[model samples]
Target: MPAITHQQALDRLAAHQLVQVIEDDVASLTSTAMSYAKHDQHLTVAGYVLPRLLARWNCVLNASNDEATPLYRDKTVLALALLLHKHGMTETAITKRALQAIDNLNAAVALSDAFFRNTDAIKALLNTPALALKKRPSTRDSLTFLRAQDVVAIQLEQYYYAAYVHEISGFNEYPIIEFYRARFEHRPDMAALQGCAAQGETYNDGKTRISLHAVCGMRHVPDPANQFHLIATGITDQPDQSQLGASVGLHTISNLFQLQGVMRKTGV
Candidate 1:
């Protein structure tokens, strides 16, 4: 069979022109739908329709079975991350513009739950054992430019959210850095912010262009019961804080410190 172009698939879907295929081929169809869904803008069409179609594949295949291969793992993670990150955006934006896309405080909370719930691989990675590298000297020079402030600045890039802090405790940095899907929400007032303080406006102003707030910085807390405590920072106006947090937390837990990803945007 001839492969369909993205525009062709979209046009077909728009015109409700679906092709007939065998029941056994439902998985392939679902995968095709997913491919199209990736670029589709109409959530009513993509979210509602694609999920049900994907479910047809699930019904045929036993999801409980450990048939997960490397391709499966990578694809699912990326897909879930993308879906979880989606928020009616069809194009990429600068750090400022991206903030408006995912700054809804509640989104962070919702996505946090969805992210962990949707992907077992992420959970496994979080719980797995991994190694870490020794700390290196800071490369930052212009020390005078560094300001002390408590605020969570979430950077919403393409599909991910990232949080930055002025300084974190033990790690020789103040701002606790974390990345998460744009769908989730983190609270600066929660225990997560006990060691940190919020700075700038309550909501993301256009200047800082953070989702939750303008900026969030780590508060210096005395005593250290939880090593993670030092790492604790409020979920300020950052979009990717949770992803970064999960990524680093999983790395710290799984000994997988060598992982890397592209930094598409920044709140700093």
Candidate 2:
């Protein structure tokens, strides 16, 4: 894989439709502050902004095509967190609002038998390590909320990277697990990667060699059979599979890895 320039990466991110959506939403949310000022009322991040953001995302998720449902839902949650933070919401408040959105969406999915008719499949999807949203501590009043916020922030970063990859790669249908596994394999030092933002190593999936960014923010566990399993939280309902070894796109891997580094260094 060849190295890309920082300008190139930023340009791609700027051109991405998801980023555009986020920017527009941020602008709109900021404009709402004017209305609050006029009414002599303080803007409520939790009670008002959060719910409105959730509703908009609910509509986005509901309107998503079946094939892109997982990607859409994951990115929507990430986008929601970004918007809330941009509006000056606290970490605790963001965690509570994000968890509420996740629960509501999961409940809605549970109600729909069409999404997963088989009980075992539904259980597998919902019980997967990646979908373990409830595992994060719910004590929003304590220091634990900070920990929860950190975990959720990392998860959101992973989702954002995945969404960026999906969009730039022309929406290829690779398994989410494999995508993260590839990311884990190419774990680059995020601090250094941010300095360049365009450098990556070529990954060979035995069949083809593709340029991939050395992104971070994914957690992994040892798998006896597969060597490693990516802990792809907040990104997909798909269970990990030993059979998936497909190669993702060049720009997909390159940009995500670089963005991960940026997120880590800036703590954004």
Candidate 3:
């Protein structure tokens, strides 16, 4: 089957009222917990967590029962951890809760051999090539081009978040890294400012691109907890360059780390 476009995925969500259902699910789950000192605290985390969960649930629901079970289980661990953390649960407590629900986290980790194996977006991304840029385009044209790429990055971030929560076997990284690399290569100024030179670029005077290295390093981290911290830190420490660059960096790092988790689990 042909992969769905970003617009088609959005349409699917709207058609099924998927956002509302997931939002309601989060609300219902949090309703009994004490309200945050400030409501936005909960809103902030929900904003971060829901869209990804919705994407996963949408894919899982459409998949076969056998395929959905393990996907659902993996997502469940992530969802519970984020939700509990929003309610101010400590890491130790959160680990305990996840452990109690899961027979063995390591065994569950071993069930899958790849990050985002069950997500439709990953399939779509794998099939799609990096965006091709036109030379000397107008400001409007450039904006349109960047926006198109951003949509794919948005979809990738969902799966990246899922992989971060529970370790996976392998992460398919080529398409995603290529997507960002195309953008950087096309705009060396942005690339230099973001410290993400394309392969073999001498613009940085032989200093390795820190952002690029960060993504590659994720494949080596064995502990999910440490890996999670690394990813969060990367997002927070992103250079304040173009907003699009920041967004691309965020998703790119996520893809790399998830790929890393997959590598660690599968010994790749």
Candidate 4:
């Protein structure tokens, strides 16, 4: 595949669309990022390079892991850890030790899962707190609170924001349409799609337990025919606009990978 510029990736990411990084199609990108060091194109490589790649891979791996469900795969977890280390995020001794453990294929799945499931350890590695609310400062916005059920409702802020851009920009808008279409409708494989939907189902229209189904579940499917358009109807408001935006956007993609790891289990 032909290489795309950093600008292209940023545009796709900012616009809430998929870049080549997640799909297996970005072999060129992987090589390109790697080449920065060898080709002397980048000076010691900016922190963004690996983080961006890890973030993208994290999304895919997170989704895949979630779908694997009651049986989280060891290879998948370890592979992602190694990928993260390749980037520059592995600073902690705990992470280094975990990475070493994850490298062992003969390691017990239960043991590996237990290590990854350590809420405090994973949080320390990521430099984020273990509390879901503390971690989700942005998600609290655009979520309406329903007192009776202890639920949080999301009004789909990013989708609407992107849709507005699509309507106004009106340039190659079909890709944007196809993006959400795949997310809300054109589900991917059963395991992945079901996991995505299940992830979404975890949250409701309440402030306490907002769902981030969009980030993990939304699979950007290919559609040659520009058939889907943004739904002009159904818009609701949730609190924590910026936080939710960060989590849903490219910035928080890596965290999504770890979300299924410990946070879900310990309710942190």
Candidate achieving the largest TM-score = 2
Full ranking by TM-score: 2, 4, 3, 1
Q: Write one digit per residue (lDDT tens) for candidate 2, span 117-138.
A: 3323322222222211112111
Across residues 153-197, which tens digit of lDDT does each residue of candidate 1 receive? 221212222334334334443333333322213222333433332
Question: What is the TM-score of candidate 1?
Answer: 0.17
Clashes of each: 53, 3, 7, 22
Candidate 3 lDDT, 1-268, residue by residue in tens: 4454433332322222323233334443333222332445445433433443334333433344653454344434434443334333323443344344333433556333332233344334323442322221111100011111111111122222111111122332222222222221111222232443222112234442313221322222211111121222113223322422222232233333234333322201
Worst 10 residues of 2 by lDDT: 140-149
Model 2 error, position 138 (Å): 34
What global local distance difference test value does model 2 have?
A: 0.32
**TM-scores, in order shown?**
0.17, 0.28, 0.22, 0.26
**Which pairs in model 3 have colliding backbones?**
113-169, 113-170, 114-169, 114-170, 169-262, 170-262, 219-260
Which regions of candidate 2 fall more than 4 Å away from where they truly are? 1-15, 42-46, 62-67, 90-268
Each model's lDDT comes to 0.26, 0.32, 0.30, 0.27
Count of clashing pairs, candidate 1: 53
Every model: Cα RMSD to truth: 22.3, 21.0, 21.1, 17.7
- Tell how far residue 94 is off in model 2, in angstroms: 6.6
Error of 4 at 72 (Å): 3.8
Best by lDDT: 2
Residue 192 lDDT (model 2): 20
